[model samples]
Target: MNILKSFFCAGLMSSTMAATSMVSGSAIAAEVKLRLLETTDIHVHLADYDYYRDKQSDKVGLAKVSSLLKTARSEAKNSMLFDNGDLIQGNPLGDYIAKEKGLKDGEVHPVYKAMNMLNYDAANIGNHEFNYGLDFLKKSIKGANFPYVLSNVYVLDGDKDPSNDKPLYDPYIIINKDVIAEDGSKHMVKVGVIGFTPPQIMQWDKANLEGKLRVEDIIDSANKYVPQMKEKGADIIVAIPHSSVSTSERKGMEENASAYLSKVEGIDAILFGHGHLVFPSKKYEGFPGADVAKGTLNGVPATMPGFWGSHLGVIDLTLSGETGNWKVSDGTGSVRGIYKRDGRKTIPLVEADAAINEAIKHEHEETIAYMRKGVGKTTAPINSYFALVADDPSIQIVTNAQKWYVQKLVNGSEYDGLPVLSAGAPFKAGGRGGPDYFTVVPAGEIALKNVADLYIYPNTLRVVKMTGSEVREWLEMSAGQFNQIKPGMDGEQALINTDFPSYNFDVIDGVTYKIDVSKPARYSKKGEKVSDGHRIVDMMFDGKPVDPKQEFVIATNNYRASGGGNFPGLKGDNIIISAPDENRTILANYIFDQKTINPSADKNWSFAPLSGKAKVSFTSSPSAKDVATSMGFETMGMAENGFAKYRIDLSK
Candidate 1:
């Protein structure tokens, strides 16, 4: 207990304290150096360019971070680089390869090609890896020269048998590495790597994963596998957890599992991913057992490299004694930033690695060629600066595309001639992604890059049957995006709840509604109903009051159809058409089918009446100048953390 606190405090002050302690240590004390290199959620970022904008960006790319990795490795004698997963399926490059240029038999994925060049020691699979289906994933995995480690996911044995199912990949891998102890004595070390991703994959990507695979909870997988690795003569065990640190402790079967996984007995350290966030910083200041400045939780060292290769995660551990009897005496976790987003400006640290840039040069050029192709022309500008405050055109185009595709699929079926509805969420709204994150396509020719910007992910299309009341409940959940405003209150109130993910704020296109922010939210993100205050009010459909039993076919994505956001009244059984097409393709094809696209939000959603001045403040992009007041926002000017402040007036 004393040792844990001592190391925690030592790491709190960082290197200076550790250096001071080392000098005062006994003369016989032995010390050795080891570094753990991690790359998580790379998401096919091969170059420092934004495919959506069709321009070079200093903020992202694996090639840029690969340069940092080489420098980091050069400083350490005993080091191993491991990718923690989510390497595929994020931007336009991943989409073009998935939908346009299909990977042929034995062809290596561009992500793996670059990763292989980096010589990753081991890796695991993240939820996004299944976006292209099991076959594509298998072929991509085959391209990696390093060992693939995954502990939880399993494949069914037979059509009628699941009890005897086996793991889809190896549960763990032990790598033999060289280490130099005190007195310059060299010894061999066995390092075991175990990995776990979100068990909710069975729900998020059900169409491709159901009836064929099963997943175990992350904590369960760690308890079952860590002991086995320990028994296999591993001197040190490193856990590659493709999950975020949960907000709470010992919360059973949650999506973010790093916090709980650290409590497991045999685990030495944790490498985090899947949240697309940076840790060991001020972001997790008061989190349980998490020392942000020290980069640890429960005395166990953990690190999560920022997503899209924006930052490289580096952990340094000082080992003592011989390699076979090595013990981690001191540890610290930190991130190397490639581009620091100071307000609106970004500061780049380094350029792309020459080797990686040259290796994937062909694919990089092809991806640009694909993104630059003109799809159609737009009469009006499309941007997400005011998406949350008002019904938005960026989302309108998506809903229109989904409704068009779903109507075609059910032309002669039982759902034919049924009232079709679609749900679209603003993907590029300003939040954790910063001010420049919002999509801005000017009034001109629309290209594949514009389409990619409108819809950021590669989620598949799905049509779900829902009742009117259920639809209202869905709107109520979406209303969680706003904060409660009291009537007659004088001071300015926060309008948007930053904790709510922008992708889950689905707005129904065919319906007109008002969100009463004075009421408390009906349910939390975990589907737990905490209060009964109704936020959704005046919900009407087809110019008439909607009935509780009225049915409608709603077009959405696979993630929402199978309950990714825990919205009320949603289940897989309600899905009507699970179309095997990417939403990005549907959007692009829809725009191309119509020579000109002129989409404008129909004012379907609004804030309900309040007694006092209907004033609330929100943050958006500083570039929303010409369209700010036109979209119903009173621009306040640029705020902190790369966001522009704005005020919304419901009385306007």
Candidate 2:
């Protein structure tokens, strides 16, 4: 007989309702309820404020989620709170603490000050946790009141096998807790918790972890240690993989491996994230081995809350049987949002936790003042509203800054005299972040916050050398951001593929090309060749066609140069220059040196004309009308979810 008990499947319900029904009026059946609460991918939005826009926001903040945490804990007699990582870095507050304020020997990070107040049981190591280097990460986490658990990261001792290596943190922790049973008797339940991070951290943060640390595969690490946790008197095991749930087949080292991790034996429940998406919602209704209604992946209950403290993931497990033979008989998983959206209005579901706000008050104010200091000036407004549709000034400025910085570094080196191109993407273009997420820097003094807004990530500058043929292949991979449209297709076709992340759509400067949306995409989002389509046409450099064998240097971020998005041909080996300065700081320096700058797109790229009068449409912020009309786009009135629809005639 299998020791793992089969879960009772049921429709989704509120955490309170599930807790009330499970524990109310029960016989002496030795039944117990264990409520697990999770917060993942917070990205350090400690307060209800948008640092990019420098204003109060109703959409994100941990201060607001704290109230929801209180209510969820109140509904259950036995509860444990766990953070799924990505807590130390995201917003300007995180940057302020990591780059400006600096963590002293015993000084606690502001985010930790707030998290310690909430009393997190344990936290998994997220990929972004290594963004500020290993030293900063170590000092920051030292202030946490709770222990951090990770099974994959290791420090090898002259062994090739990870099993022989020493772990950076404890692989798992078995917590012994006393809880009231359905029979009104006290029972000690030993709950085991284990964690796994994306193994690709080695590549993403190569500068930080290359020689010091090694990461094992997520599934392999789980298979290695889960049985040990079971043998050590753990009645139940909960897995917290800082990874997303994917329906893709497992081939090892996948960034999203929760679906594969769920198949590991002894994993009674799972809390997964890193995709910044919500599970148990309609978005994941049809994924393989997923029961959205029951909130289970392969019959194991799981939950992934939205990022930036927007939702609280709740997993309630009801175990029944004798003391030593207790098993999970029933469970339900769901996410509770801090706010709700009704058209353009935001309805707050919970108030900000006063205690959390008070804990981080000093740091929050300092971050604001630090972000407000002016760096330079911009003669024209820079916005990412039309970054995907056309060559916009927002991306143009970043590319220009990158090219300027790289040119100085590689001036007389072995890579000198090569044609330098730059790649930039819109990080703030709204999708899941809502309409207010786009960057809008008005024509005036450019502050440090505005520079941070343009480049949201803390990616360092890198230059990769590739042949012209390989560069085209790089652009081909970015072309996956668009959906294929048939000529003379009925109705308006969607122009952009919303499923494709805006960050992956790289716009290469110093080259001109046209994207033929009528043709099939040559590459998929995963860099797999699914079609033989050549969507890039009329590619030119210096008023002539680019030679296939010609060599060129491309300035980009470390993430892309190190195969962060799985782009073709370019990897860590080809990178010639890995500058220590961050791209945001370079941009700030470029702007400061210029004193006053003008940002205007060179119109290096556009959509190829269709044979017939085909029309395509995409949604953007309602405030983007002036920019759209100035570019001669036809407005299609208001769209759903407070977006303004615009149509483009491809036949033009």
Candidate 3:
């Protein structure tokens, strides 16, 4: 039996209510059950195996999710499958396909291969799809039989934002699927599927998108196309937006705008992503019109399938229609988890689907071989266990590469001779990825797999001009990683704020500062001024107090430079150079050029000295036990969940 649970709030109608809504006899319109299945942020996991670890992992893979798809489809009479973007690039396999295997003019990427074999009805373009440039994206999707809808982006008429004059892709697809009613009679159901991706793609992918395209705001595009879908005789409209409901404001051109998108007049349901979070979760509590218990926003049913094929987003709509038209009577949303993550262990629900594994068999084999090749050697062990506690090498190498690349890229340009800074973050630190997820590359010859472990995302390098004050705000946002604590009253206060993602804890190189955790955060992750105290103190550049007006070039990934984490004063307009190189490739080149890369992290930032004795605790991999003290932390022995708890004596 499917472990299906309803996320309906009290007084909200459910499947039980749908059964009671039908009229008594022939006076009843036809009641059709439509199952809309969505897979999002798959990130090129076509199989159940981790190409880097060379082991089977239950936590990912579309093949394992394919089993869930078949089961989900079997439970309903009429079903439609969709991919909510971010499918083309993410893992070592995706990197291998892009760097080694290479895409020919008409060849299909393995991601599209698996997506096509799964019979995706329609898919949207994800921001990462633009990582390899437009030609690559255009060529990669050639093998897909289904249409890829992108409502917001447009072909530029003369170098401006998306206009009504031209759309880059098909705005929507009206699928004329034959529906079978409870009476065993079949009728045509005009189901409209419209897709919206982040309009910030124009900024995040400025290198590839500048002169070629302009992406309109998602809410604006939805307001325009949703009505068109209705006028085109669509019975039901399902929006597959590669965006999420992440911000506090329910309106704006915010990266995650699914909540407002759902409020549009004609949209019946929405699938949101790119934040890699599970919706209908407790994280969305207190938002007006957002019923976490009901998996809805503004009364429109929605769901976000977890990333890496972890779960399948399912929305069931009970439609009762007249001979020529249909209206949604009852609707509900739920997600099916293919694996159960318990601490360090994962339990798979089903085996990998045979057809999907067979579909990308060759690419998988090649990717494995590519990841194992030695890139260069490291002078010392590189691990991220101490990332939050101290400056870490895993982040240092990436920043060093960015700084190196950007310094050279801006050498002869109009912004020459300006001091360069780089923002670095621990990507593989133990957070949502679990304790064992921290990067641990032993001192030796580093392989492509280790490089992937060091830098996980496929973000490209960028250089943005930032004022000293804006730079302080950037560090202030990164300093939000800590939990506020009084000097003498703490007992086992968590060192890191669990809610703040490790990815956004950026350490700004080429400067020095102190984070005073006793003070409330200057700004929350949502850019809200929840408190007024500034945690970033003694922020300096070049041995002098940072001048608020002084301009400095900071090398950063496209995500941060394009206001990805919502950092202040950072956006496309400030960008001076948008390199077409991925950070991983830049790191590989830097290592290869140096031959013996030293894993050294500059102690640029540290916690402020407290007035009295205070203590805090954090969890790290058990492997960090032997080296905990040398890193200035006292191990409190292993916890029951297999993590090593360490205590920080702030008095030191």
The 0-to-1 C-alpha lDDT of every candidate, in the order given, reads: 0.85, 0.90, 0.82
Encode model 1's per-residue lDDT on 1-652: one tens digit a residue: 9999999887776665445444443223457788998989988888888888788888889999998998999988778898889987888788777778888988888887788888788987898999889988898788888988889999988765656889998999988877654444456678899988888899998988998899888999889988898888887899998899776546566789999888999778889888888988788899989988879978888899888888888888887755456677888888888887676788888888878877888888999998899999999888888889888899999999998898899899999877899999998997777788889899999998899999888888988998999999898888888878877778888988887888889899888889988888887766778788889888888888888899899999999999989998776889888898889889999999998988887888888878767788988888886688766578888788878888977543
Per-residue lDDT of model 3, residues 250-312, tens digit only? 566778888788879988989888878777677678876788877887888888988889889
Cα lDDT tens digits, model 2, 1-652, are 2333322222223344445534553233578999999999999998988998898877799999999999999999899999999999999999988988899999999989999999898889999999999899999999999988999999866657656778988989988867777545666788899998999999899888888889989999999899999898888999999999776778888889999998998899999999999988998888998899989999999999999999999999999864556689988889999998788778999999888889999999999999999999999999999899899899999999999999998899998899999999999888888877798999999999999999999999999999989989999999999999998778879999998899999999999999999999999898899898799999999999999999999999999999888899867999998899999999999999999999999999999999986889998898999999999888888887678899888885
Best to worst by TM-score, what's the order? 2, 1, 3
How good is model 1 by TM-score?
Answer: 0.93
Residue pairs with backbone atoms closer than 3 Å in model 2 (clashes): none
Which stretches of model 3 miss by more than 4 angstroms?
Answer: 1-28, 159-164, 282-287, 292-294, 404-420, 464-470, 490-492, 526-533, 540-553, 572-580, 627-629, 634-646
Question: For this target, which candidate reaches the highest TM-score against the unseen true structure?
Answer: 2
Model 2 CA lDDT for position 302? 97
**How high a TM-score does candidate 2 get?**
0.95
Q: What is candidate 3's TM-score against the reference?
A: 0.88
Question: What's the ranking of the predictions by lDDT, best on top?
Answer: 2, 1, 3
List ranges where model 1 is wrong by over 4 Å: 1-30, 159-163, 249-251
